[model samples]
Every structure is written in C-alpha cells, then in structure tokens.
Target: MEHIRNFCIIAHIDHGKSTLADRLLDMTNAISEREKMDQVLDNMDLERERGITIKSHAVQMYYKFEGKEYTLNLIDTPGHVDFSYEVSRAIAACEGALLIVDASQGIQAQTISNLYLALEHDLEIIPVLNKIDLPSANPEEVSDQIIDLIGCKREDIIPASGKTGQGVDKILEAIVKRIPAPKGDPNAPLQALIFDSVYNPYRGIEAYFKVVNGTIRKGQRVKFMATDKVYNADEIGILQLKQYPKDEISAGDVGYIVSGIKDAREVKVGDTITSADNPADAPIEGFEEVKPMVFAGVYPVEIDQYEELRSSLEKLRLNDASLTFEPESSAALGFGFRCGFLGMLHMEIVQERLDREFNMDVITTVPNVSYIAYMKKDPTVPVKVNNPADFPDPVKLDRIEEPYIKAQIISKSEYVGSIMKLCIDKRGILKNQVYLTSDRVELTFEMPLAEIVFDFYDRLKSISRGYASFDYYPIGYRESDLVKVDILINGDPVDALSALVHRSNAYDIGRKMCEKLKELIPRQQFVIAIQAAIGSKIIARETISALRKDVTAKCYGGDITRKRKLLEKQKEGKKRMKQIGSVEIPQKAFLAVLKLND
Candidate 1:
C-alpha cells in the first residue's frame, strides 16, 4: 500500500490558496483533461462568484514521483477572518499545513493569525511563496519576512506561481517528505471526524469526514457520537471535485459517506462518526460550538410568498450549517423568522441567494449583535437578546458587555495620521505600531466589534487610495453603556429596524439613520412619516413625499389587458414594502438605515 499524507492549504484572503489547489490537481492529473473546471473544490455558486472559500472542501489524489506513488489528501480552508472557526476545524484534520504567502505583499494580518493556529495544533508547517509570475514578485524579501515572523528556515520557503504552475512539483514533493504518514490501526472500529456536510434532493444528506483510526465500507452500520443516531452506510466515496463511488476508505483518507439521512440537522459538522458495533472510546474533543454573531429577521414582500421564503431558507441551510432560523411574529409586519449568521458577509450572501436563486422577493431586518442582560437581580441567569425590542429596561441591565476585536491595518506611511484620527473618532484604542518597510507601516488597535462591523474598512481604503488592508479578530468583551433606539412608523414599533447604540451618540446616529431611510424608501401614494424615538422622546424624524401622480392615469375600456397589467405592477411594487397602518416602508429602507456609518 502507498503512503498517505494529509495537509491543508492556508492563506489570507485573495492570497491564491484556491488557485494553488487547482494547479496541484492539474499537475497530478487528479482531474481528467476533459473534466477540468475552475476552482474545482469551490462547488458553490456563491463561493465561485465571490472568489473566496466560505466552507472547507476536501479531495483525495494520487501523485507519482521517482516511480513512487503517494496518496495525497488535501483540504481547502476559508481565508476570511469571519470563518476562523471553520479554519481551525480544517487544521485539526490535517497532519501539516502549507502556508501560502503573496510574493508582492509580504505578510498580512490573517497570515499571522492562521500561522499561530497551526503552531498551536503542533502541525508541521511548509511555507510556500506564491505569485512569482507578477512583475512585482519579491520571493527573496517575502522569504526573509516569513523566516522572521514564523521562525521557519530560509531554505524551507518554496517559491512558485500558482497561476503559471511554477514550482508546484516542489510543493507536492514537500508534502510527501515533510508530512508524516497515517499510522493508525485499520482493524479497529471506524472512527471519523466530520468537518462538513450538505443536503441534496436526490442523494439526501451527505457527510464529509476524515477517517482517523479505522476502516469503513459501503454496507457497514455507523453511529454519530454526538447525536447517538445509527445509520447504514448506503454509499462510500472520495470527492474528486464531486462524489465518486468507492468500495471503501481507510484511515487517513478524506471522503464522503451517505446513509439515507433526510434531516439536515441530524448530521452536524465537527461531530464524530463511529461503527455501531464498537463505538469510539470518546468523541474527538476540541470541537467548539459555533454561535451566530449577527442576527436579523427575514420576511416575504408578498404575504402569499411566505411559504416560498421558508423554502428558500431551507435550501440555503442545506449547504450552510452556520445559518440558523427561528419562527418570529412581528406586530407590525406579521410572521417571519429570526435568522442568525457568522458575520455581515454571511448574512448578505444568504439574502442575495434567496433573491437570485429562488426567484423570491425578501424583506430583511437590520442585523444586530447578541447582548447579555440580567433581570430581577439574577446573577446566574443571563438572557441573550438579538433585537432591541427583546432587550430589558435600562434599569434592569446591571452591566452590559459588548464584544471587542483587535484590528490590524497596513497602509502607506503618509496616511498614518489620517487613519489614526479616524480610528480615534470611532473609539479605537491604539495598541502598537511598527514600520514594516520604508513606505509601509502596520498599526494595531483594540476597537469595539460594532465599529468595525460598519464600513470602516471601506473608509480606510478610500482615505489611503486603495493602498490599505485591514483585518480583525474577536478579542474579548468589555462593559459599555448601551441603549436600544426603536424606530416607530405611525406610532407603532417596526421591530425590524430597532438598534442598540452607545448612549453618547444616540441623537446623531438616529438623525443619520433616518436621513438614509428617507432616501431609500420610495414615495408612496400617501405621505409616510419615519421617526426614531427612545421612550416617548423623538430623536430624529423624516417624511417620504407622496407620489406626484398615479402611474396609470390614462386607462380606457378598450385597453383592459394593458390596464390590468399596469395595476398588477403597481400592486406588486406596493407589496414590496412593510405597511404600518397607512405608512409604506420599502425593504431597502430598512437595510440602508441599519448601518448609519456605512
């Protein structure tokens, strides 16, 4: 039998990790000549269009060097900071990591964070310098920086261009020599670590896992350690871009197993799967439950499309286990679901998919952070609140803890003063600053999560003329004086647009939010008043001017079909709004005003 080597490709966003994976597949002929595809592992449409790996994808291949065949199991991990939890899970499944660094841009914030995670796991690290084909390629300089930052040997740096397939053979050779082979007992009971799963109408729910210490076949019965549910394996296969049937997968192999599971919730990522007869001694530890950091409410524009909206969410959840939903009833907007996500990008992807894929119109509420509240002097029991409407009274809140993040920014030396001034205005605490190069500098700051959730990154890039890159990670929680500012339309709480803000900037924030709302909300048949208030005190108000005239005022009896079509269009337009008794508010209005600083 050939030796097995497992490794993961890690890098910062836009650092060419996915591209390198594709080149490796081509070099090894893992994908057939006719079956070649772009970003072969990123099968999701959203992932391909966005040019980022949102989920972890696994594939098994064979490489022959010097007449010796080696089995390579490769896992592609997400590069975005929001999916750090997923990245860690991928790292745990591998015996080593291949760190990819941009030749032009030495090292980034995410690069340092991921490198630290690999070190924590005690995985063998293979540093690779990519993008050598570019005109500004500086492999020598980047290699020096990597040696300084990560303490890796200067000779360990493999220089290559993933775009041109340069030095790809060297990377494959390193994987075989540096990463240790799997040395587990194959006769033992099946035990695997599930890193991801997906649901398909024809195939049911499929699971992707790494066989850590045993063998599994097509007909064996297995049980999930966390759920305690038994299932008969109907099929076993390796994912060659897509699932390919296999008789069995032994230890150290990355593949998928399907057992006729219909419920997506039954199979969760990070759970363990073992044989039914002789289960594992204990479930693999170190799996941290993912809590959605951002919350929002989703409803259909047309009341009759409620069922369609729910179906769309179900389809989305089939592939994405992080997206969560619970039925919610709104006093002003009727029934909907309160959805939770990892971050703003995740939330936006779901919303956009619903509209683009399912051909359904959806109205989403403003995204809010989770808050812990204490009521009636109960120190032990803490309530998690997502909406301001769900928040307790100010007096009942003994102390409020908000999430904080450590942000690192890189920019030209000339824009340092302007960037620092902006950070201070947003309540950022300077941590440290270092000169990375003659013209480049790295600045670190501790800032509230709420401040970074807005368009702060975009503003920083704009001020620096697109020469700045920023990244952040959750540090901890700190005490802050926070209050919920509720928006009212026609004297009733909208519930969808309520937000929690610092007590100091309540008035200015409310005014700016209301102004954006007025611009996004289209003029209705009747004038609609928008107001932001805190307990009977109005902080800001704006009005949407009434429609100047009817869109179809020249309808005649001879053109009944045309008139009917026009009326249908008008009614459809009206349905894309939340009506508060007599006031009409568009869906875009709620989204536009949610992040005032954005």
Candidate 2:
C-alpha cells in the first residue's frame, strides 16, 4: 500500500491539465512512444475539438524511483466549472491533487474553486505552475499568487512547462515524495468505492473503482450497497491504456470490475461494492448527490423515438452520472424527458453527444434554473418547479423563490467596469471585489441562477477579451418578483418555450424573443403571429407575412373589380388557412430564445 500513489490533476479550463498528464504518462513510460498524442486522456472527439476535457479519465502507471517500483494511479479531470462533479469524484478516490495554474493567466476562478474542493476532501495539494514556456508566462508572479492562495512555500511550487516536458521528472519525484500513499487494511471486508463507470456494448458495464478495504477478486460475487444487487465479477482488471485482467486487486489499488451487468441503471456512481458473502459494515461516505443547476426538456425530433431516447439517456447516464432526467410531456413538443444539467455548457455537450454518439436528433427547449413555488393555500409546503410548464397558477401562488449563486470572476482590471455592468444587467448584486494584483481583480457577485443561464458567459468572455475566468456555486433560494413568460404562436401558448423570469426584465426579454422568433420561424401559407405574453397581457408581438403566390398576376389585365375579387378570394383563403394552420416551430426557434442577447 505504501508503494501506491493515487492522485488527480485539477485546474481551470485550458490550464494544461491534459498536457501535463501526457508528460507524466510519458515520463512514467505508461504509454509507448507510438501511443503518444496530445490530450491522450481526452478520448472523446468532442473534447478534443473543443480543446477541453469533459469526462474524467483514469490510468495506472508504473514508475521506478531510486530502484523501487512504485504504482501510480492517475486520474485526469475536466477543468470546466460545468463538470466540477467529475473533479469531485476524482478527488474522492485519490489522496492528493496537482493544482495546475497557467503562469500567464495566474489564478482564475475555477482554479480557486477546484483547489477548495481538493482541500475540502483533505487531499494533499501540489501547486504546479504550468505553461512556463509561453513568452508571456510570469512564473514569479503566479508563484506568489499560488503561495497566497494555498499558503505553500515558494520553493514548494514547481515551475513546469507541460509542452516541452520541462520539470516533469521533478513532478514525478514530488508525487512520490509529497503525496501520501493509499491507506487501507487488506484483511478487512471488501469496500470499494465506484468513482466512475462506462458502458461496453459487447461486454457490459465496466465500473472503475478504488478499493479502500479488502480485496476484489475475479469471479467474486459482489454486491453494490446502494442498489443491493449482486453480480459475479466476470473479469477484474487494472486500467492502463487498455484493461489488463487480474486475478485480484487488493486494497489501496484502483481497478475495474466487469460483471456482465447489461442494465445501465443497475450500476450507480459513488456506490460501494462489497463482497456479497462478507460485506462491509457500512458503505463509503462523502460522495454527495450531484445537484444540477440548469434544467431543460430534451425531446426527440421524431415523436416515435421516445423509447429510444430514453434508452440512449440511460446509457449516456452511465458515462455521465451528473445528468439527471425524468419522463415529461409538453403540449408543444410531445413526450420528452426534463433533464437537469450542471450548466449551459454541460447541457450543450449532452445535446451534441446524443446526436453524434447515439445518432439521436433531439430538440432541447429553453434552459432555466429550478424554482421554489409556494401556494397561497399551502404556504408551508414548498413546491419544487423545474419546468415552467409545472409552475403553479400565479393566482394561487403566494410567492416564487429563485436559486441564487455566488459568482466569482477573475479578470483584468481594464474589463472590470464592463463585467460589472453585464452582471448588474442580469439582476446581480455586487457582493465583494478585491485586487489580487495591480492589474488583476477578483469580483464576487450574488446573481440569480436563471440570469446567467443564457448568454452571460459568452458576453463576459467578449467583454474581457477572453481574459476572464468565471465560476459559481448555488447559494440556495431567495424570494424574488418573478413572472412566468410564455411564448404564444398564433395565440396558442407553447409550453416548451415558457420560462420563469424576473419581472424587471420580462418585457425586454419578451420583446427580444418575439423579434428573434420572427426571423427564425419560416413563413407559412398564412400570416404567423408570434406573441410573448404574461397571462392574458401581450407584452410583445411580431408578425411574419404569408408566402403569397401572386394570385392577382393571372388577372392583371382584368377589370379593377375582377382584381379585387381575386385578392378578396386569396385573403379569404388565407383567413381560413390561418384558422386551421398550426405553426411548425423549427428547432432553431426554440434555441434562439437562449441567445436573445446575441
């Protein structure tokens, strides 16, 4: 157990976590020269294309230090705030973390947030200054920041460049010397915490876990404590670039168990796996349930694919445990699942995955944060409302409370004015601000979760010229004057497009939604009326003229009365069509509401 060092890499998005991971793998000789690649741990094409890690990946490495063979279990985690749950789980399974900070960008929001997470888990933090090779890199300044943030000594911070492989050997030496090894009793009953899982179509679900106590052997009957379901371990193995089957994996080791469990729902992340015969007294604790901040409806483009969508979501959830969904139906979109996502980026990635991985074309409705609606009759009972369609009648509602978040933004001092303006426009209150350096500032704000769900991040990035890093966490609910805004097409309310928004911005947002929908929705045979309403009051309206076929061209040479008759006939036909014509809202229209500011 002393020879086993389990740790993860934590950082802000694009702070060279994956690049540093590659160098570590190369130095440890975990992967052959032929297998060397950029972001080798990020296997998803979407991840590589976006230049970000979306999922946490784990691999085992063998490093020889001073003639002693040491086993290193390295878990690479995503740096985005939307995938913080991935970082949390990775931290839970390890004893230490490499806090990577970009020397040029210094300490950003996610960098601080992830460090706090690692600290909360009592993991040893190794501050590493990455991207030292950049021309603009300021290692001395960043080192000072790291020292102030984590209270580490100056020499303890390692200045490393993940690109040129500089200081990688020193990093390995630090991992061996600084990070504590896994501690557990091999004689105790089997208690393995499943940190992550993946679905294998040919084999079954492969659960990746860390053995905290006792041994997990091949062919052992294991029971998942959370599900209380037992299954024979078809194969037990260590995770390298590939799975290497082992007869047994003892305590303080990281490995995988393939039990031929075809049902994806049967396996749950953070569940404890124990020996069925001699089970542990209790399951491992400290893994909190993932709380999704953003909620939206994911409906199949084709209604008949509902069951297929459900199965796809089930399988996808095996890979991404943070995603939560339940069956829901909408009058506008038919049957669908209301999915809870960590944020806008997570929601977009899931939508992209469903299309590319499952070949499932899905329509995602407007994303919003969940609200607590109190009824006038039952004031004591708080009704949780995630979907706008589930919102109780305003007449019977006493008040609505919206989720608020403590938003931390680190940016250049030059953009402070613009960033503050953007946040304030979103109904945010400035809670605090501090200057980390003469030119760098950290601003904290209390903002409604729903305000930032749409284009806040995009605008912030633009305003800061990509110099800002933002992170946030829910700060519970606060009473607010919020109203349900409904988008009506031809005077019919579309439940999928309804949203609970603050009353202050309701009229402006409604006007923008109407104007955007007018451009996106195609012209029908009759005039299409798009109205944004709050109950019976129409706050905004836009009209798309009918696609005329030039009916009067055939009678151009006729008398004025004859032309009038032809025009009258056409107008009558349009009126009849408008009465029976149901608007077919394009998918872009539903997504346009999310980009109203754009």
Candidate 3:
C-alpha cells in the first residue's frame, strides 16, 4: 500500500483527459508502442465521433521514482457536465487528481466544476497545463489562472502536450512524489467500493472496484452491500490497462471481481462489495446514483419494433442507472416509453445508441422537466408530472413548481453582452460575474432547467459563435408562472405535443413550435390547422393548405352544367372530409419541433 498511488485525470470536455491518460500509460510502458491509439480510454465509437468522454475507465501503471517502483492506478473520467457523476465517483476512488487545463482554451465551465468536486473529495490536485504544442497555447497564462482559481502556485504546475508526448514522464514522476499512497488496512474486514461495472457475454458481470480494506480473492464469497446478493469471486484480475489475471486484490489496490452474475441489474455502479462471511460493519461512501432531470417520450418509428425497443431499453437500463422509462401511450404516436435522462446530451446519446448499437429506429417527443403540481383542494398533496397526458386540469392546480439550475458559462469577453442577453431571454437571473482575464469572463446565473432544455444550447452557440461553453447543476424546484402549453391539431389535443412553458415566453415559443411543425408536417388531403393553446385559449396558430386533387381534369369535355354539379359535389365531400379526417403526423415533425436549431 505504501508503493501504490491512486489518482485520476480531471478536466473539461475536449481538454485532453483521455489523451493524457494514454500518454501516461505509454510512458509507464503499460502498453506496447503498437497497442496505442488516440483516446484509448474512450473506446466507444460514439465517444470518438463526438470527441468527448462518455465513461470512466481505470488502469494500472508501474513507474520508478528515485530508485523505488510505484504501482500507479489511474482513473480517466468524463469531462462533460452530463457525466459529472462519473467524475465524482472517479475522484472518490482517488487520493489525488491531475487537473488538466487546456493551455489554448484556458479555464472552462466544466473545468471549474471538476475542480470543485476534486476539492470536495479532498483530493490533492496536481495542476497540469495541457496542449502546449498548439500555437495558441499559453502555459504561463493558464498557470496563473490555475493559481488564482485553485490557489496552487504557478511553479507547481506542469506543462505538457498529450499530442506530442512532452513532459509526460515528468508527470508520472510527479504523481509518485506528490500524490499520497492509498491508506488502508490489509487485515480489516473486507470492504470494496464498486466504482464502475460492465456486462460481458462470457464473463457475466465485471465489477470494477478499489479495495478499501481487507482482501478480495478468487473463490472467496462476497456480496454487494447495496444489493446484498452473494457471489463467489470466480476470478480476480488487475486492470493493467487490460485485464490481467490476479490471485487476489489487497486493500488500497484496484481490480475487478468476476462471478457468474451475467445480469447487469444485479451489479450496480456505487455498490459496496464485501466478504459475505466477514462483512464490514458499514459500507464506504463511494458513489452517488445520478438522477435524471430531463424526460421525453420515445416511440418506435415502426410500430412492430415496440417490443424490440422495450427489450433494448431494458438492456441499456441495466448498465445505465440514470436512464429511466415507463410505458407511455400517445393518440398520435401509438405506444412508447417515457424516458428520463440526465440532460439533453444524455437523451441524444441514448437515442443514438438505440439506433447505432441496438438496430432500432425510435422517435422521441419534446424533452421536458418534471413539474411539481399541487392540488387546489389540498395543497399538501403534491404530484410529480413527467408527461403532459397526466397533467391535472387547471381547475385542480394551485401553483406549479419547475426545476431550476445554477448555470455557469465561460466565454470570450467580447461575447459577454450577448451571453447575458441570451441568459436573460431564457428567464435566467444573473447571480454573479467574474472577469477571469482581460479576454475571458465567467458568468453565473440561476435559470429554469426547462428554459435551457430545448434550444438554449444551440442558440448560445450561435449567438456566441461557438466561443462560449456552458455547465449547470440542479438547484431544486422553484415556484413560477408556468403553464401547460398544448398543441391542438385540427381541433384535437395531442398529448405528446404538450409542454409546460413559462408564461413570459409562452406566446413566442408556441408560435415558433407551430411554425416549425407546419414546415415538417405533410399536407393532407384536407386542410390542417395547428394551434398552440393554454387551456381553451389559443395563443398561436398556423395552417397548412390541403393537397388539392385535380377534379376538373376529367371534366374537360363539359363545364356548363354537368361539370358545375360535379365540382359542387366534390367540394361538399372535401368539406366533410376536413371535418372528420385526421392528419397523419410523420416522425420528423415531432423531432423537428423539439429541435430549435436555426
């Protein structure tokens, strides 16, 4: 334990967290020169395509410092705000963190977020200025920013570029000299914190854990403290950047516990693993389960794949605890699952995975936040409404409360005025602002999560010309002037198209949704009318003219008497069809309204 060093790489998205991990692995010779690829820690194709980290990965490295060898355990974490939970779990398992900041980008919103999390975990922060190879890189300036923000001295900061593999060896040496070795008792009752887990076809389930105390050995009986399900450790292996067989995982070391538990639901990410015969008195405070804040209804584009979509979601949910779903029915959309997600990006990821990985084509409704509805008769009985179909009548509602977030944005100083305007337009209350440097600024606001759930990110990017990056955390529910805005298609309410909107922006948003829907929805045989309404009051409406059939084509021979009567009959029949006929809204319409990309 004295020679073991457990630390993680923490940074903002696209800030070289995964690249640095690869460099560290290469420097330690954990992998052969031929075995490396860019962003080796992010194995998913989706992650590579987006150039972002989606999951947390752990690896073991061996390095020599001052004639003494050290076993370095490095956990690479996601840098996006959506995966902040993963960052926290990674930090919890580590004694120190290599805080990587882009020398070109300087400090970002998620950079500050991870820094605060590392501080809260009491991890020794080793400031690293990455991407020094770029022409725009300013290591000295970033080091000064790190000193100002984290209170670390400029001299203590290490400058390196993961791209060019510069100063990586120095980083490894610093990890050994600065980061404290794990402290735990080898003879104590067994207690391990499961930081991550994955399902395997042959291996059943693999529970990745850091042994807090005692030993986890093969053939030993163990159980998860959270689930209380007993399993014999069929195999033990060290994560030497790859699975290497091991006889036992002693305290303060990181390894995986493999049993015949193939079911992913049996093992959870934050569960404690301990000896069944001599379990610890208490479980360690390891990881927190992420709660989803955004909710949407996902239905199959082809109705026959409903069962396949259901099974796929079930399988996905086994590994993703943050994803939640329940059976939901729509009059226009048929049957589907009402899914909950951590954020919009998370929602998009699940959808993309379902399509790319699971061979499923699913259509998702507009994303929304759960609203707390109070009964007028009894204010004590508050109900959480995720779907608009279950939203109570206006007569029975007292006041609705919606989720709010403490939002932060780091952007160029030139775009500060527009960013503030954009935040104010989204019902954001400016809380604070700090000019980080002459060229950069950090703006803080308390905004409704619902306000930013739709097109706020896209608009923010557009308004700032992609110079601004935003991060946010939930700040609980706040009472507000919110109303359920329902879309009525040809005089019928479509529950799936309903949304809870703030009164201030209700009219404009309703107008925009109607217009977008008009563009996406096809022209039916009869005229289609789209109306956005609050209760019975319609604030916005748009019309799509009917696709007229050339009834006069066949009447070219006679037009004086016979054609006039035939045309009159055709017009009457069309009027009746318009009264009773329903519009078949395509899948694209639902997706288009949810997306407000300009």
Candidate 4:
C-alpha cells in the first residue's frame, strides 16, 4: 500500500480535465499515444459529442520514480454540476484530488464548488493550471487568484497545457510525492467502496470498487451493504481504458467486480462491498444516496412504444444511478415515466440516450422542483408533492414551500448589473458579492431552482456575452406565494400543461404560456380555447379559430335558401363535434413549449 496512490481530477466543465487525463495516461505508458482517442477517458459517445464527461472512469497506471515502481490509481471525474454526485463518490474513494483551473478562464463557479467538496473530504489538493499554450493564457493572474481563493501557496501551483502535453510528467511526479499511500490492513475483513457501476449484456452488473481493506478474488461471495445481497464475484479486473481480467484485487487497488446479479438496482453507487461470510462490522461512512434535483415526465411519441421505452430507460438507468423514474400518465402525452435527474443537463443526456441508443421517440414535459405543502386544516402537517397532478386544492393548502438553491455566478464586472436583474426577475435574493479580481466578480444569490432550471443559464450567457459561468446547490426549502397554474384546452384541464409559479409572476407567466401554447397547438375543426388558471380563476386566455372547410364553395350557383341550409347543417355538425371531439395535440407542441432549451 505504500507504493499505491489513488487520486481524482476535478475542474469546471470544458476546462481540460479529460485532456489532462489523456496526457497523464500517455506519460505513465499505461496507454500508448497511438491507441488513445480524444477524451480517451470518456467512453460514452454522448459525452464525446457534447464535449463533457457524463460519468466517472477509473484506470490503473504504472509509473517509475527514483528507480522505484509505484501503482498509480487515477480516477477521471466529470466537472459539470449535474455530475457532482459522481464527483463526490469518486472523491470518497480517493486519497487526493487535482484541482485544475483554466489559465485564461481562471477560477469558475464549479471550480470553487468542487474544491470545497475536496476540502470536506480532507483530500490533499494539487493545484494545476491548464491550457497555458493558449495565446490568451494568463497563468500568473490565475495562479494569484487561486492563492487568494483557496490559500494554496504560489510556488505549489503548477502550470501545464493539456493540449500540448507540457508539465504532465511533473503532475504525475507530484501525485507520487504529495499524495500519501493508502493505509489499510490486508489481513482485515475485505471492504470496498462501489463508486460506479455499469450493466453488461451477458455478465450482469459490473461494479467499480476501491478496495479499502483485505483482498477480493474471483469466485468469492461479496455483500453489498446497502442492498444486503450476496453474489459470487464471477470475475475481477482492472480498467486500463478497457477491462483486463484478473484473479484477485488486493487492498488499495481499484478494479471492477462482476457479480452474476442481473438487476441494476441491487448494485448501488456508494454502497460498500465486503466478504459475505467474513463481513465487516459496518459499511464505510461519509457516503450518501444521490437524490434527483429535477423532475420531468417522459412519454413515448408512439403510445405502443411505452414498454420499449420503459425497458430502454431501465437499461440506461443501470449505468446512471443518479437517474430516477416511475410510471406516470399524462392527459396530453399518454403513459410514460416521471423521471428525476440531478439537473437539466442530466435530463437532456438521458433523453438523448433514449433516442440515440434505443431509437425511441419521446416527449418530455417541463421540468419542476419538488414542493412541500402544509395542510390548511392541520398547519403542522406537511405533504411532499412531486407532481403537479398530486397538488391539492389551493384552499386546502395553507402554505407552499418550494425548493431553493444557493446560486453562484462568476463573470466580468460589467455584467454584474445585468446578472443581478436577471436573478431578480426570477425572484432571486441578493445574498453577497465578491470581486475575485479587478476584471472578474462572483455574485451569490438565494434563487428558486425552478426558475432557472431551463432558461437561466442561456439568459446568463447571453447577458454576460458568454463570459460568465454559473453553479448552484440546493439550499433546502423556503415558503413562497406559489400556485399551480393549470392549462385548460377547450375547458378541459391538461395535466401535462400545469406548472408551479410564484403568485406575483403568475399573470405574466400564465399569459406567455397560453400564447406559446396557442402558437404550438394546431387548429381543430372547432374553435379551441387556451386558458391558464390559478385554481378556479382563469388569469389568461387565448383563442384559436377553427380551420374552415369552406362549405359555401360548392354553392355558387345554388339559391339563397340552399346556401342557408348548408350553413345551418354545417354549424350543427360543428356543435356536436365541439362536444365530442378531443384535441389532437401534435407531438411538436409539447416538444416546442416544454423544452425552451435548444
């Protein structure tokens, strides 16, 4: 264990984390330069297409220093806010972290957020400034900013270019020097932490674990503490960009365990695995379950594809433990699942995977945050409502509490006023602001997560001219003047069209939603009324005239009486159709209105 070093890389998105991982892999001779692809650590095609890391991957590298051989376990982690849960699990299984910041971008919202997480884990941090080859590189300024932000020494900060592969050897050397060896007893009960898991078509659920103590070998029965299910380790292996089967994995080694368990839910992330017979006294501490922060309804475009969609999502969820879903029915989109995700990006990635991987067309409703409502009759009793369809009558609810988040926006000084206004429009409270440097500023606010989940990021980028970066973490619930605004299409409530809105902004939001819906929904044979309401009161309304068939076209040579009879007959048919006819809401309408992010 003295020669073993386990560490992970953390940074803001698009800040050269993956590139640095590639360079390190090449430098350590773990993967040849010819064998490596761009973003080699990122295995998912969606991740490569989006230029982001959607999952965390671990690999073992062999390095030589001072004529001594050392086993280096490097875990590459995602930097996006949505994958913070992934990052946290990786950090829990590591002894140290590499805090990578862009030379030109300097410190970002997530850069600090991830740094705090590492500090909480008490991991030794190695500050590395990346992308020094850029012409706009400002390494000196960025180094000074890190010193001011995190109190790391000036001389300790290392400068490197991930693209150019400069200073990568120095980084590897620092890991061997600064990061301490794993301390565990090989004679103790076998204990391992499952940081990630993936589903295999034939081998069942393959889990990635960091051996904390003892040793695990093939054919041994292991128990997952969270599930209490014991399964024989069909195989054990190391991931060197690919799986390499092995007979045993000793203490302080990072590798994959294949248990013949087919169910994905059985092998959960953050669960502890130990010898089934010689079990540890307790599971590892400091690990918690990942809860989804955003929720949306996912319905198949073709209702008959519901079962296929369900199976596809289940398969996808096997790899993504952060994803959650349950069967849900919508008046507009038919049967589907109410899926929960960590953030908007997570939701998008899952949807894209379903489409690209499964070839299933789906319709997703607008995303929402969970709300807690107090009963009017019993003020002390609180109810957790995950769906708008579950919302009780406004009269029965005494007060509503929506999820709030502590949001941080790092941008230039000139855009501070605009960002403040944008947050205020979303009902954000100004908490504090700090000038990170003369050119850059950090603004902190207590904002409603629901408000910014969709348009906030896009709007922030627009106002800041794409110079600003944003990050947020949930900050519990707060009481608000909230109401569930329901959309009525021709006097019929559409559950999928309902949204939770603040009372003050209800009128404006309701009106805009109605108008957008009016434009999206196609005209029917009979006139359709689009109305948005708060409880029994309709706050906004729009009308779409019926598509005329022009019954008078064929009556040019007919008598006036004949034309009158034709009109009366057509009108009578229209009345009956209005009562019996249901609106056919096009698939595009839901796709266009619900998904404002493009």
Better of 2 and 3 by lDDT: 2
Cα displacement (Å) at residue 312, model 1: 4.3
Report the C-alpha lDDT of model 2 over 480-531, residue by residue, as the tens digit.
9988899999888989888888898899989999999999998999988899
Taking the tens digit of each residue's C-alpha lDDT, what string does model 3 give over 458-551? Answer: 8888988977989998889989887788999989988878888888878987998899999988888888899999999999999999888777
Q: Give one digit per residue, the lDDT tens place, for model 1 in 422-458.
A: 8998889999999977777899999887766656766
Model 1 CA lDDT for position 205: 85
* Candidate number with greatest TM-score: 2
lDDT of 1 at 464: 88
Query: Model 4: per-residue lDDT, tens digit, 1-598?
Result: 8999999999999999999998998888888767878889888899888899988889899999999999999999998888898888889999999999999999999999989999998899999999999999999999999998779799889899999999998898899999989889888999998888887888887889999999999999889998889889989999887899999988998999887888767877778899999999998884567888889999988889999998888878777878999998986778999999999889889989888888988888878888999997898988998888989888778998999999999999999999999999889999999998898999999989889877788789899998898899888999998888988999999888788888887898788878887888888899999998998899999999998788888877857998889889999999999999999876566555444334
The TM-scores of all predictions, comma-separated, are: 0.90, 0.99, 0.96, 0.97
Once superposed on the true structure, which residue ranges of model 2 sit more than 4 Å away at CA?
A: 556-558
Count of clashes, each model: 0, 0, 0, 0
Which candidate number has the best lDDT?
2
Residue pair clashes in candidate 4: none
Model 4 spans > 4 angstroms off = 591-598
Q: Which pairs of residues have clashing backbones in candidate 2?
A: none
* Residues forming the 10-long window of minimal summed lDDT in candidate 1: 574-583
